[model samples]
Target: MISRAEKSANYLILVVFAVFAITPILTVLQAAFGPSDAGGGGGFGNFADAWRIGHFGTYLRMSLAVSVSVVVVSVLLSILSGFAFGVMRFRGSGPLFYLFLLGIMMPSEAIVVPLYFDLRSLGLTDTFWAVALPQVAQSVAFGTFWMRAYFRSSSRALVEAARLDGASTRRLLWQILVPLARPAIVTMTVLVFMWTWNEFLIPLVMVTDENLRTAPLGLAFFQGQYTQGFTLLAAGAVIVATPVVVLYLFLQRHFIAGMLEGAVRE
Candidate 1:
């Protein structure tokens, strides 16, 4: 148990960190809605201008497509692979899982140059699949690792009980285990969404098509536009960030619960 003084210190530290985290967002909001000079406008005006100038509508839609595809495919594969690794033991399973560990350990920068050439050789460059497929692979690698740990730590007694009741493997996984793993699943989904949404290098390297540009890439280009000012830039940042922020808030309870659960398990 924590002492009163320790609890107070913890609260103080949390407050400090909270303020630190919020400060930049508050500053960006101020700049985003700040008064404009010359012929420009403030508040919604900057956002509107930024949206139009940045072509973020198209960029965001493309990003949404990639993110959704990556999340869905990767998380599903993660669940299946994780279940196999965590719940069942088989020959060479340890080495194969360790091979996946390489994916998590190796940075994209190391493989990206070769990957781009490989994709080009396969004639997949400048396409939606080009931008999304690599990310899917990367996300799956991490997601597998993540979900495997969750399943491994899950209540084996419950699993045994389900088995004794004549549950099929499919029923056991989808009906019994998956429901209980909601918080963990949601946590992984949130993480993958954030990662896929923010991925720059993959999309940048794979697609040169303007229509395939992701939000971050678009923002980078938007910032380069000479006519755009600081307010507009800030507004663009806010726009790009809003979806992930909303997602995290919507899944906040589950995400936090998963984090705490992982901590306890660790």
Candidate 2:
């Protein structure tokens, strides 16, 4: 139960946050559709022009390719590595796990110079794999750590039952752990998708060719080349942002549940 004053305060806080969140978005939306001479000769017209001129359709396709590939590779690698660390005991496993954890603390920028040089040496610079492989490597650390925690926290009783039934490692993971960890898997998938979709710096450095540019880099190019057409840039921004926002809205429940229930008590 709440008092009238408390309810008023709560509503006031909600209003404040709403303004904070919506103001820029509304401004962009308006700019996206405003009439010409709304400060520039370009308006929603600019959006259509940019989309066609910039070949944003192709860029959108390429970005989706990179994002989906990153998510799939990252999730698969995380699951395997996490199961190894969580369920399989081996020599030096603790140290190896800590080494993976170190990735979480380090910024990707710290190794960009070396990474770029390495990719160049491998003839991978300007390739889709250049952007994707690094993202996979970087994301793997946290993804494995997260999934390992989820697996460890899940029912040991079930694991024991499976073992008594003579379940092999593959059987346990495929038949038991994977199904039970669906919530955590979905959360990690969304997180990886969001990260890879929005990733900019690595792609910017590695992919010098225009055809290989990710959406964020494309947005940067749009902003730079079409400075007067703010509406087009705004529209582009909205296009890039919409998919992840929709995904989050859909999977937010599983994401929350996974985080809450993920870590094992040791």
Against the hidden reference, what TM-scores do the models get? 0.87, 0.91
Per-residue lDDT for 157-218 in model 1, tens only? 98899999999999999999999988788888887888889888888888888899999999
| Regions of candidate 2 where Cα sits further than 4 Å from its true position | 36-47, 254-266
Report the Cα lDDT for residue 179, model 1: 95
CA lDDT of 186 in candidate 1?
A: 84
lDDT of 2: 0.82
Candidate with best TM-score: 2
What TM-score should be assigned to candidate 2? 0.91
